[model samples]
Every structure is written in structure tokens, then in C-alpha cells.
Target: MSKSLKAICAVAATTLLLGISAANAGKYNLGRKALPEEIKAWNTDVRPDGQGLPKGQGKVSDGETIYNEQCAACHGDFGEGKDRWPVLVGGKDTLKSDDPVKTIGSYWPYTSTIFDYVRRSMPFGNAQSLSANETYALTAYLLYMNEIIDDEKFVLSDKNFTSVRLPNEKNFTKDVRPDTPTQAQQKPCMKNCKTEVKITGRARVLDVTPDAKKE
Candidate 1:
């Protein structure tokens, strides 16, 4: 190549390398370090104990309007899930089924989870679309549809929120295991010490004849 051509190429390469380095330099840095207020702004998660939930009120009746405008397209008009989207109502007795049809009232353990889940991720493609009051109304409507709360009941604001009880609330339990090892599981290893691992058997194939398998 000519001397001029080589010089131009070297300059171009240096400029490209510098641009890449500058673009990625911030990626490796500690990252501007989020301010305390900024952190608080994004971390608006509400706990099951009714902590961090904003001050707002929403009734099932009000929720109906919001649902039809924003949610009915994906989550059926009656909260019945569309084409395997996710059903939000019914399933009162299917928690123990082989293919359990779980809903907020049937499997969820607390009402706060509904608020937290909806606030963080919901409306399918558009997340964080609803405000605190809207989320409250939607949650209340879902509860009403699941038969856990009355349609006229209001669920919002911290005062009334904590009082709301989910249907599957009785399914939860506290972990009572001791910090250290307990007598029930810590027996001294003696006889069948399992010196080495061994593969005993393999599953049998039903109809495959070692060829022409469905991929």
C-alpha cells in the first residue's frame, strides 16, 4: 500500500479503537452509584406485611372500567386468559390437581403479592403501566372475581390493605429448623456409608426402535 494510504488507515483504526473504549469505559466503572433517593424511587416494592404500599384506594367497581380499557385485550374480558396467556380467575379447588390451575385466590398466599407482582410486572407487553390506585383497583377486582372479596369491597390504602386475606393464606408455614444441625437428620454415618456412586439402571423406551425418532 502507499505511504498515504497506510497513514489514513492507521488514523482510522486509532479513532475507532478510542471510540469503542470510551463507549465501554462506563460499563466497567462502579456505574455512577445510584443516589439514595433514586434507589428509593425505583424500589417501590410492597411487602406482604403491607410495607411500602402507597396511599391509595381502589374498589372492584372502579376496576371494571380500567380492566376493559387496558387489560381485556390480553387477559379476557372476565379475566379468563386468552390462548394460554394466564387465567386470573377461578380455580378454587384445582390447587391439588395433577395440572393445577393456579390463580391469585387459589395458590397465592397473600394479597400483597398481587400488588407487588402487578406493580413490578404486568399488562403483558407494557409493564408498570398502572398507578398505585389503578393497581389497587385491579387487585380488588381480581379478588372479587376469584370470590375472595365482595365486588363492592374496597382494597387500597395501607389501612384496609393489611386486613385483606387471600383464600390460600392458610397454606403458608414458618421455617422452624434450627440454625445448627438437628437430631432428626444428623445421624452418624456408619454402616451403608456409600463409598462410591453407581448408576443402577436406565429408563426404558416405549415405542422407539433405535431409529426414526421424532426430533
Candidate 2:
């Protein structure tokens, strides 16, 4: 038999043994898996500079409504934080203070980080439950709460989002901690390294304690 005929017969035998019908067998060409470029098309994420933001509109009032229905229970009505959950407003100059408030405006570096974080994870029980417009509105509401912007509307489109600067934009710096191998290898010692600990000042000094000390 010819080499071509032998190869065709071998394939046919294999297909028959595997119970694959002629109509189904030999109907496809083997190809490589999807490329990174193909996968990235669906994985859109906005960056601090509004790199991947989509076009959408949202108002602070609209966000208030959404927050009431979906987020208020956990995040509080005004983003003041519920129970032990984190607050989403204010903070500002507290970054340099001892007891920093660490709110959205005071601690967050990028406005886009808010949208990106919420898009990726938020609403606690049902993450990614909010639409782009809803996310924008919620972001605007948080901004209002932080006094970054007055109670105005904010629609987080690529064009508008990049314009929103965070109040604590300078609070955090890029990781400048030495990346040198020696530094990375060194473990910080916790005990008795300093010759003396001085009480230069108190952070929160009270006139008197709630309970008086024994005489």
C-alpha cells in the first residue's frame, strides 16, 4: 500500500476504535491556545491615570441610592464605616499624624484606585455587583463625604476620572525601601536596640484619667 493510503487507514482505524464517526472525525485543525492579547480584551481595568476606564456616567445622588440598597448595611449610610469596617471619607492631613484616619480621600493615592478596587471587589456579599455607572456614582458620593468635592455629580468616564485627584495623593510614596539584597536579608531587631527611649511628647495627653490613681 502507498504511504498516504497506509496513513489514512491508520487514522481511520483509530477513529473507528474510538467510536468517532466520519462526520465528526477529521473535521477540525489543531491550534494553539488563546494568546495573552486575546485574553486581555475582556480583562479591562482602569489604572491610576485612567488607562482602562470605560465611558459611563454616575451622580452622587444615584450613588446614594445604590449605597442605601446594596452597601449601607456594611459601609454605613455616609461611608463613615460600620462596626469595624473601614471608613471611606476624610483623613487628609492625618497621614503625618500619629492616629491617622485613613479614609478614602486622606489615604488613598488614586481616584482610579477606588473604581478599580470596587470593580474588582466590593459590596461585600456580592462583589462586582455594581455597574460602571453605579461605581462612578458611589465614588462621587465618597468624594463628597470626604469633602474633596462638594455634593456634585461624578461620572467615572476615562475623560473625567483622570481629572479627579486624591487628597492623600502624596501620603504614600512608591516603595523606596531599599531593594538591595543585604537590606532584604536583614531582619529588623525588635528588642533593646536603642540606648534610651525618650518621651519627647505625648500624642494624646489628657488632663486626667477617667479613673483617679490610688494615692
What TM-score would every model get versus the actual structure?
A: 0.64, 0.64
The segments of candidate 2 whose C-alpha lies over 4 angstroms from its true place after superposition are 1-32, 35-42, 151-154, 176-215
Q: Candidate 1: which stretches are off by over 4 Å?
A: 1-36, 153-155, 173-215
As for candidate 1, its clashing pairs are: none
Clashes of 2: 1
Candidate 2: global Cα-lDDT?
0.76
- Residue by residue across 1-215, what tens digits does model 2's lDDT show? 99999999999899776764433445463444567998766576778877788778788888778878887787788787889998886566776789888878778888887888887788886887788888888888777777777746544455677777976676565787566666456787788889988898753454365565544
Candidate 2 local Cα displacement, residue 60, angstroms: 1.2
Candidate achieving the largest lDDT: 1
Clashes of each: 0, 1
Residue-by-residue lDDT tens digits, candidate 1, 1-215: 99999999999999998977765677564445568999888988989898889888888887888888878888799888899878888788987888788888788888898889888898767888898889989888878888887647555566789888887889878997685666576887779889799987644435445665654
- Ten residues in sequence with the least summed lDDT for candidate 1: 201-210
Query: Against the correct fold, how does model 2 do in TM-score?
Result: 0.64
